[model samples]
Every structure is written in structure tokens, then in C-alpha cells.
Target chain A: MADEPRKIAFICSKGNLDMAYPALIMGWAALGNGVDVTIFFTFWGLDLINKARVDHLEIPPVANTSMKMSMMGIPGNLGIPNIMGVLPGMTAFATALMKKKMNELGVPPVREYIQMLADAGAKLYACKMTVDMMGLKKEDFLDGVQDIVTASDFIDMTEGAQIIFI
Target chain B: MPTRTYAGKTVEVNEEGFMLNPADWTKEIAVEIAKEEGIETLTEAHWKVIDFCRQAGLASGKAPTLRTITTGAGVPTKELFTLFPKGPAKKVARIAGLGKPEGCV
Candidate 1:
């Protein structure tokens, strides 16, 4: 009889197209390490799992790069358009770079990573406020999103869990 | 206090212990300062601009132009936009430690 795993949660609050990776990476990492992980997608962070938005998800170098730089010293105002992320070759290049980095570091792709966490019994929740603001219905998100929740519900559920805001 | 060459500028660690002076600094300078402040292990792309900002300063009195920095760093101009959301190159270059390029306020 092994002890139960400790739980962790990633609160994805960044709705920016480029800021989506941290939450996914952290959640996936927790799962890989055998932690019981949960992701609470709130506000713009819900865009990553949004069905309509997911297909169009592009990692615009301009905005994405600026966001990363912001963590270093760059201001958010200097970022470029997320639309530039859609440039066919551009998107591929960015994705390749990120994927390569992740692979080298033994991380999984976003889709597979999320699935792995889910399979390990990690929960994923979408904020009800985001769903409403985006004019989305419960059915609009991916299949694995466990349930819709208010922030309070999420906070309660995440009690005793190490939480990260991405 | 830790010290590092940011965009070729010797940015001294501030009282707050952040690497660069936060008073209107560019993203590039900010990153280097962050590194000096112990945010080591920067991603390659970040290294790219920091390197470029340094190289450009070495070559000329001013920071490289946007085109030059982008070309030098081998990063797309669009990507540079993300690193520096400010309207022009000088602002970012300044923060990067180039001390503001020409034609910048």
C-alpha cells in the first residue's frame, strides 16, 4: 500500500496566445512525476482548451517572444500580433523550436501531455466565467475537461495542493 | 551585488537586487539584468538578442537597427516584436543596455 500522491494545480490565467505553454508544461510535468495534477483554466487561459480556438492556436513569435522577454525585463506593450503566429512557416518554426526544446528535456507535446495527465487521474477544469464570456457552452471544450467550476469551487478543490498561476 | 554585461553595458545590480535599472529599460537589457540577478539558464532565443545587443554595441556607438538586430540574432522581425512590444528598436535596445538608439525619445 503506497501513500497517495500529493496534488498540484496550475491556474491558467493568461489568455494570450503565446502564454499558454507554461500551464500545460507544468501540469504535464507534475503528472510525469507522479503527482496528482489539476489545471484550473480561468479567464483567457481557457482559450488554450477552447475547441474553436485550439485548432487556430498559433505561437506568434512576436507576442510569444515578448511575453518571455517580459519575464526577463521586456514590457508587455512591446509584443507583436498573435496573427503573425498564423504565418505557415512561422508557426511551424516556432512550434518546432519549442517542441525540440521540450523533447530534449523529456517533455511531451501539449495534446499528449494533457492526455497523459488526465489518464493519471489528474483533473482539468474550465472556469464558468470564461465559458460565458467567450459565448461558449459546456460542449465547446475538449472531452477531458472534467467539469465547469466557479473560482470558489476551484479554490476549495485545490486546497492543500501546490498551486501555480500561469 | 552581481554584475553582468547587458547589451554591452555594464549594468550594476540595483538596491532592489534586480540586475537592470527598471527606470525605462528595454526588454533585452531586462533579460540580461535578470540573468545577473540569478535568472540564469536563459533560453537560446533570449540569448540571441542579448548577444546581438552586445555585438552591435561593440561594433558601433549605438545599438543595432531593428533589421540588423533581427538579422544578427537570426530571429524573425515578428519575433523581435514580441520581445520588445514598444514601438521602436531604441526603447528595447536601451533596456537591453544600448543606452537608446538614434531618433528615440
Candidate 2:
């Protein structure tokens, strides 16, 4: 076989900003390594590519506290308990802190990041099953998504590729 | 590091290099790289920071500034450190796969 880097596939299932970020991160990592990367957003993970709802993603309480602590630069073992995420103003506090930190670090907001990823040739696909289940129309998704397909189709395409289910 | 069989072949990877024997790079390595840089893992929020950096790197072939990353990550610019105490721009950039950045080595 030629020395070409193998193709990679990412299957994402959740939709919150918390879950959405990982798939995108991993996808870009593969691309960075020069691997041919394709991301298949399934179930709620498809929310990230949804134009109307993409901007509305919020962290669930179950997923917020850890996110809060992590944003504070705390280690996992040292992070705040998940229950504490329900405390008044905690999410806001965490959001504000993270925004400030991002500013200091020079990271861009979501739309720009999505645009950037698209520009880099990251192939994005939506799960047809999820789209039908959600009753979403084709225009409901963002511009970067390449196409929609079944799980079987995704599997077929990912044969021989590094497959990650996020 | 973790190993799995794909198409009757095994690929090895670690934080450092990609190899045939499942090179040892793993989440632990990514976390270690983050921690050594003094970047505390605040929460999923901070991950969004890293996520944004990845998108920027993937989209632009260049690591983005704090403002640009937050914008891309869909969070306000003021709230980044809640997830990355070492600062969003630098820490997330490191985690996003651009280590030491330009001119820092």
C-alpha cells in the first residue's frame, strides 16, 4: 500500500456545546496530522450543524459543573461536583470566566470557528436518520455539511479509516 | 494508550508520533500536555476553547487569537478562563495541536 495517511471518521451523538466541541476538536486533530477526515453527526450531535439551533446550545446541569471547573483551570480530580452546577449563577459565572479567558487567548467565537473548519476541508455529514427523526429539512443544516447518509453508509465509507464514536 | 483492530490491521499512536504499532499517544498525553502548560481543565467550557482552536486550525491552518477562537467556539470573549485558567488563547491553542506556537521554540 502507498504511504498515504489513512482516512478517519468521527461519529457524534450529542448536541450540547459540551458534546459538540469534542467531535470538532478530534476532527481537526486528524486533519492536522494530514489524515483524511470525515465527521458524521448523528442524533443530537447533528445540532451543531443545525443553522437555527446551533447558536442556542447550552450545557446541561449534568454536564455543566465539570465544564465550569475545567474553565477555571482546575484539574479533573480537583474539579467541582456536578451537583453544584445547579447553584444559582454558576453557569453564568462559568460562561463569563471562559469568555474572558478565550479573549485573553485570542480564540474566536463559534461561527468563525465553523467557517474556519469548513475552509480547511473538514468533510461534515449529517445522519439522515436523525434528520428525519427531528423532522428537519435540508435547509435546517449549516452550509458546511457535505451530505446526509445512513449509519450503514457511514460505516461503509469509514472502512479502513480510524473510526471514533464521540 | 489504547489499541483496537481495524480492517485486520493495528495502528499505533501516542502524543508524539504516528506509527504502525499503535503509537502511544492518548487522551492522557493530551491532558498531560494541557496540564504541563499550566492549563487547568475547567470544564466542558474549556473544552469548547480547545474545540474552537481546533476549528480555527482546521479552517485557517493558523491558530486563532482569543477573540477569534471564542467567536468561533460560540462563546462570548469574556468567559474563556472559566474553563482554562492558564488563559484561553494560549492554553486552548496548545491543546488544539499547535504546541509552543510560532517563535516560542
Candidate 3:
């Protein structure tokens, strides 16, 4: 091991079901490499730490241009038309399909990932400005959240660390 | 690939020192690898994780990820960290004579 452990910090600003996994997966991998991990959740990303919203996150297909028919097990290079994405229950369908695929690969749910990261010593923080803007209290966040911190505080805390903004 | 001696037995290992062949593993080799990872003593708890990882890794042809070890081996994530500090998944795999776990979680 190096004299000082490598440090990587992720700034999560989105909260879609698909968007949430990138930081979690990368952070877990970093931990396996003995790197220090810190994650800051701001804006819509605060939903990840919110007790009421974390598990119930939905992946809205609308405006998600990358969504393809192949993701739904259809054989084609065709993309799902944004027109169809606006239909009722499309978000639910998309979220369910993604969750099923993840489960089949033995991937844990979002809440479990958060718990696992916490147990493995990753530092999780909710953005204080977002929390205040949304009128959320500390109790509204998950158990793993260390604290609600300002953007400046997060910058100071992650000095000299590789930063990934998502 | 590189070969290193552990417990007087030469075995193939990767550049990072993880065993390339799970069949070449032994209890003595595990103890020696544990020492190299800064764990001087292998407690019963440590052996439980090691045994589970070895069996699971051999059965699956790949080492188990941290989540698999916790759920499949019935070890708590935090306890696994205490049993094998720094990086439990990688450290346990190295000591258990298994390939490095390839999963992200």
C-alpha cells in the first residue's frame, strides 16, 4: 500500500435510478482498491439519501435519448421514441425492467448499496443548501449520511482528491 | 505471470500477488499470505471468511464480491473489514488463494 491512501470523491447531482448507480458502483470499486471514498449529494441527487425517496426512485424515460429497445430485450438498434416515453406508467415500467436486470446480475438495490458503502467506511454527505432549500431535516436522510455540508465545505474536505462530477 | 514461494510451495501469482491457481492453495499458504497483508494472526473468524471465499471462488470459477461474501458467507460487511483491513474483498481473496474479484460491488 502507498504511504497515503488514494482519495476519490464523487459529486452526484442527478437522482434518476440509472444515474444513481454510477457513483455507487465506482465508489465500491475504489474501496476494494483501498482508496478513500467520499460522495456529495446535491440538487436532485439528494433523493439518494432521502429516506422516503431512495428506494422508490424512478427512471423517467422521457428525454433519456440513450434508452434503447435493446434494453427492453427487443432485438434492434432502434431507440424508444420520446413520444412513447410520455405515456402513463412508462417510468414505472422502465424502473422495474432496470431493477430486474440488476437483480439478475446479483446487484444489490440502491438502499443496500448505500448500507454496504457505509459499512465499508465510505463517507456520505447530503448537500446542506439542497437540504435547506427542500426543507429537509437531518432525520430525513439515510443512516449512513455523515452530515449535511455546504459546497465550500465539501471542496475543503476533498482537497487533493480526484473528483468525479455526475 | 510470476511464481512465488509460500510455505515452501511455489505457486503462480499475478503482478499484484493474487494467486493465479486456486488449486495450489493450502492452509499454510493462507497463513503466509495473511502475514504479507499485515495480518499476523489468522483467527477463527478470519478462517471462516477464508474458507467461505475459497469454496465459493472455486465453485464459481471467480472470486466472490464484497456483497457475495457478506450475504453468502454470512459475515457482516463491517466485521469482514475488521477481519481483513484495508480492502477486505481483495485481501481475503489474496489470502484465500483466489483470483482478484472482478465485480464493481
Candidate 4:
């Protein structure tokens, strides 16, 4: 039997710009498939759907081989030194470049993509443990978040769904 | 270089069962493949799903994922499970003569 997964769940634990897209894109794709989808944002991943910080999420180009400057039409293999990755402005530069490439490829920005996922009926859950740990309120989240949930609650919501943790 | 005698016609396929050349596909081949997958019957609804998958596969130049079929083909998830049974995406692609879809649970 092909395990034919109809329900999909994502646990987004990272807040970085690049770290966020994997779960977001996959979640969006699941919605496109007419599958039931849910995303649980915890810790720094909360920034992905945070009311005031989503669009401002940063992608650190440090230690990432995939962030090719050449993709931005620079036409060179001059990789950014690991040391430079720790410098100020490097993160912003990388985020801008990555966002531009994604835009060229017709991928929506993080905020819009999250909204699209929600609009497509993908549910969002804020982790209760992290919420309390970070002293966040429900109002800290964007609209369309289904609830604040514990791990057990998440397990119930994810029954029979393929769960991906990022 | 593997092959399968599908629908009494010799067609090339990979070891994992994806058609090596999709042009060899036909409705009769789909029927045989479906039977091999324990789907003894292909109703009109099944045809709708299969046809949609084939067209989407052509457009994308790859196997359409389960999500693609449900979203683009307009088939609901429950109906798809009922129609294709186990491994809907894999089975549908094999029957439709597309490569086995790469991403899944």
C-alpha cells in the first residue's frame, strides 16, 4: 500500500529566512494538493508568522554554499568568506539577494506566502511551550493562526499526517 | 534497460517501474497496470484522475505529485484514495506512463 498520506504537518523551529522557506513551500504545495495541512511555529520559527517581524526575517549567507552570489548575475564563484558572514550588513545583503531571486522565480515573500498558505486552508498552530517561554501573546501572531497548542495537542492534530520538522 | 510486458505490448521501464519512454502509454496499458496494482476496475472517475495526471505530467515534464493531481485535477483527497487505493500518486503515474513521482511522505 502506498501509505497515501492525506494529512501533512510541519514543525517550523528555525526563524532564519532560508530555514523558513522549506516548510512554507512544502506546506503551500500540500494545500495545492487539496490535502489537510497544518504548521506549528515554535521558538524562533515564530518570526515566520509573527505579526511585526515576518517580512523582516533575515537570511544569514554565512556557511551556506547554496547562497550563490552568481545567482544574482554576479558571474563569479567568489564565495563570501565565512568571516564576512559574521559581519554586519552581510545578512541584509544576503536576504535582499535571496528575496530578489525568489521574486524573479515568482515565489512570494515570506509574509505573503504564509498568508497564501492560510488562505488555502492550511492551519497554523503556535507552540504553547515556546509561547510561554518567550512571553508571547496570541496577539503576537498574524491573523489566521488556529490556536496555541502543546506537543500533545499537536500530536492529536497531526494524527496520520506525515510530519516534517524543520 | 529493464522492460515490462504491459497490455501484451513490450514497453521499456526502469527497475522501479517508471516508463522509460512515455510514448508507449495507452489506455489499455493503464488498465493492465491498474490491475497489477490490485485495482481491478477503472471507472469513469478513475479516467478523470488519470487523464488529468497525464496532462499535468506533460505540462510539468515530470510526474505530478499527489498534491498536483488533487489541486490541478480537482479531485478531492478522499475520492482519490477511493479511486486509486494504495499509493495514489505512484500508481497513477505508472498507469499514466509518467516517471514515478519523486517526493512523497
For each candidate in turn, the TM-score is: 0.46, 0.55, 0.97, 0.61
Ranking by DockQ: 3, 4, 2, 1
TM-score between model 4 and native: 0.61
Q: Give the local distance difference test score of model 2.
A: 0.61
lDDT of 1 at A102: 54
lDDT of each: 0.61, 0.61, 0.92, 0.81
lDDT for A51 in candidate 2 is 88
Off by over 4 Å in 4: A1-11, A24-40, A51-56, A60-68, A79-93, A103-124, A133-147, A151-165, B1-10, B32-49, B56-61, B65-89, B102-105
TM-score of 3: 0.97
Name the runs in model 2 displaced over 4 angstroms.
Answer: A61-84, A87-89, B1-105
Candidate with top lDDT is 3
Instruction: For model 1, report DockQ.
Output: 0.01
Tens-place lDDT digits, model 3, residues A60-123 = 9999898999998898889999999999999999999999999999888989899989998999
- Better candidate by DockQ, 1 or 3: 3
Candidate 1 per-residue C-alpha lDDT over A31-135 given as tens digits, one digit per residue, 9 for 90 to 100 = 433467789988877776777766455554744544343432466655545676556686556655555665565544455545544544568999988888878
Model with the higher TM-score, candidate 2 or 3: 3
Query: Candidate 3: where are CA atoms >4 Å away?
Result: none
Error of 2 at B73 (Å): 21
Error of 3 at B20 (Å): 1.7
Tens-place lDDT per residue, model 4, A55-134, is 89888878887666576678888776788888989889888888887776666688877766665567899999999998
Decoy 1 TM-score against native: 0.46
Which DockQ values do the candidates obtain, in the order shown? 0.01, 0.03, 0.75, 0.07
> Between the candidate structures 2 and 4, which one is better when assessed by lDDT?
4
